[model samples]
Target: MTNAEPLFDPSLPGLADDPYPHYARLRRTDPVYEHPAGYWMVSRHDDATAVLRAPRMSVNEKNLAGAPADDSAPPPELPPAMVEATNVMNLSLLDVDPPDHTRLRSLVTKAFTPRAVAALEPVVTELVNEGLDRIADGGRVNLMDELAFPVPFAVISHMLGTPPADSDRIRELTGRIHRSPELLDEAELIEGMAAIEELVKISREMIDWKRANPADDLLTALIAAEHEGDKLTADELVAQVLLLYAAGHETTVSLIGGGVVALLQNPDQLDLLRRRPELAENAVEEFLRYDPPIQQTRRITTGPYPLRGKEIPGGSLVMVAIAAANRDEDHFGEDAGKLRIDRADARQHVSFGAGAHHCFGSALARMEARIAIGGLVDRFPSLELAGDVVWSDRVELRSAKVVPITV
Candidate 1:
C-alpha cells in the first residue's frame, strides 16, 4: 500500500512492509519472473532451493582494487580507507567460494554448535528479562526500540567483546549497515562509508586489545584462529569484525520484531501459543516462515541453468526470494498462507537459506527468538498493540522500525 501499485516490485521503497501478497501472486503465476532490472527472480521454493544449492551459482565479487580516473592518466589506486574497506568485505565468509569459505566458517563453528547454543539459553533468558523489566512499569512501549533491538544488541555485543559503553552507538551503526546494504542511495552510501571507516578503526583497536587480553568470547576465538599456520591478515580480521557488526543483530531483530508484530495481527495464533507455551519452538519456526528477516539474496550464474521451465543464460543475476519461497503453496501445502505454529514442516522453511550458504548464526538466532518470545508471553500475557506500526523502509530485510505495544 505504501507504493502506488500492489504488484511485487522488489525495488519499491515500501515493498518491505508487506511483500508476501505480491510474492504469493508471483508463486502462483510467474514462478520465474524476470525483473526489468536485468535479473531473474526465482520464486518457487524448489527453484530457489535449486539455485541456492547450485555450485555454479557463485558470490565471487572479490575484485575490489582500482578506480578509473580518466583517459589521460593511469588507473587511480584505491585509497587506504577504501582498500581496508574492500579487504574487510572480501574476507567475509558470506562473499567467498568453497575452500576459503570452508576454512573461515570452521574458525568459529564450535561457538554456535547446538550444545553451545543450549548453553546460551540461560544467558539469553536473563537478557530478555532485563529488556522486559525496562518496560514492566510503563503502560506502553515500542517493543522494537526497547526489547527487540536491545536483546540481540546486548547478546551479540557481549559475544563480540564490544564494550558495553559502545554498545548503543555500535548498534545504531550496525542497524543502518545490515537493514539493506543494497538499498542505500549515494548520500546514504557516503555516510555509511564514513561510518564504516570509523568502525574499521575501532575494530582494529579491539582486535589488538583482544590479542593482549584474551577472553572466552567469539572474538578471542577468531583472533586466535590460524588457517594451516596462516593466520587471518589484518584486513581479513577487520573484514570479519565488520561483517559481524553488519549481520549480527539485524536478522535477530527482524525475527523478534516481525514475529511479535505477526502474532499481534493473528491473535488466534497468539492465544494458541500462549495456552501451549511448549509450542514456542514451533511458533518460532512458523514466525520465520511467515515473515523471515532477510527476504532475498543475490546469486550470479556461472553456467546456463534451467529453472521454472526456462533456461536462464550463463551470466545472469538471479534473486532467490526467500520470503516468496517460504510461502510457496507448492512447497508448504494448502495452508501455506496461514500462520499455524504447529505446522509440521515449518522448520523446513528456507528462511535461513539452503545448502553451503545456510546461515552460520541460525542456531544462535533460533535460541534467542525462542527465549525472547517465550519469556515475553510468560511475563505479559495481556500484551497488545498500543499504536500504529511502522515498517522499515527497505525490501531486502523486512523488519519493523517500531512495534508500539501495551503490556
Candidate 2:
C-alpha cells in the first residue's frame, strides 16, 4: 500500500469509499511520490503544504503538461466545444494568478468577512432548524437529499439574491457542473455549458434587477465593486456570480454529508459530540480534517522544481492529496486515523486549503456546518444511521451520493 505500490488508482471504482487507508500508507512510504500521469503526488502534510504555498506551483492549468496557454489555442482532447466552454466558465479566483486573483478575491472577500459570516449564524440556525423540523418525524430520510444539499443552497441563494423558487434548479446545475470531472463526457460537458449559460442569464437578470432596486445582499455588493474607477464587466460579473454559486454551495454540501458519514462510522465520536454539544465548533474542524470535502487539488510547476530530492520539470502536473495530508501521522500523531472531536490541532488541516488562493467562503462554510450539525443533534438526540451510506464516484470532490438516517 506504499505510494510506490500504487495504493489506489484514480480511475478505479469504489476507491472513494475509503481513501484514507491508502493515503496513510502513501504518506508513510513516499511523501513526494511520482505518479504515472507524469506528475508528483504530494501526500504528506508538510510536503503538501509547502507545495501549495510554493510560488513555483501555479493554479492555472495552462502551466500544466497538456493544457494550452490561452483559450484561443486548439482545443485539447476534449470534444469540439468543451474546452472553450470550460475556459470561459472557469474564470474564478481559483484559476487565476496573483494580481487578478487578488483583485477578484478582494471584491468577494468583503461579503464573506468574519463579521458578515458571523452575522449569518442566526440565519443558518433557523434554516437548519426548519429543515430538521420537516424530517424529525420521518420514517426514513436521505440526509443528502433532505438536509445537507438544501441548507447551504438556501443560505447562498439568500446571500446572492436568487429567488427561493429557483434554488433547486440552480442547485441541480451546480451539482452537475462541479460534482466530478469523470462524470463529464462530451454530452455532459455540453450540458454543463448550457447550465452555465443559463446561470449567466440568471445572473445578468439579477444584476439588472438589483440595479433597479438594490438590497444589502452579496449580489448588490458585487454589483457595486469598483477598481481603478472600473466596475466588473458583464462577463466578469457572470463569472464571479457563477463561482460563488458553485463553490459556496457544492463544497458545503459535501462537508455536511461527509461529516455525517464520518460521525456515524465512529459512534464514539458522535456520542462525545452529543454529550459535549459545546464542542460543535471544534467537531466541525475535526470533520474537515477527518474527511475533507476536497480529496485532491491539481497544480502545475511553473518552472523546473525539486521536491523531496526529485526534480519535477516545468509544466509538470502536481496533484496535492489534501485528504492524505490531513491523515499524515507526522503532523497529527500516529492516531491520526482516529477521529477526535476535540483534537486541538484539527484547525491546522488544509481542508479549506492555504495561501492566497485559499477558499474565500470558508467562514460562511464553517458557520453553515456548525449550525446544521448542531441543530440536527439538538432536534433529534437519538439520530442514527438508518441504512448503508453510499459515497459518490467523484475522485476530486469526496462526497456521499446518499446518506440515510433515522431518529
TM-score of each: 0.90, 0.91
Highest TM-score: give the candidate number.
2
- Kindly provide the TM-score of model 1 when superposed on the true structure, using C-alpha atoms: 0.90
Off by over 4 Å in 1: 1-7, 62-80, 179-183, 226-229
What are the per-residue Cα lDDT tens digits for candidate 2 across 1-407? 23354654676666778877778777777778876535678898888888888988888887777775556763555554444445556676778787777778878888888988888888888888878977786747999887898899888878887654477687776657664554467777767767766676666677677777778788887777732346565556767877877556888999999888888889898889888999999999999999999888878898988878888889887889999999888899988888999999999999888887788888888889888887887778778898888887777888887898998
The candidate 2 region of ten consecutive residues with least summed lDDT is 1-10
Clashes of 1: 1
Q: Model 2, which residues run further than 4 Å from truth? A: 1-7, 73-85, 179-195, 226-231
True-structure lDDT of candidate 1: 0.78
- Which lDDT tens digits does candidate 1 get at residues 172-240? 766556545556776786666666766777777778777887888988878777322575766777777
Instruction: Give per-residue lDDT, candidate 1, residue 388.
Output: 79
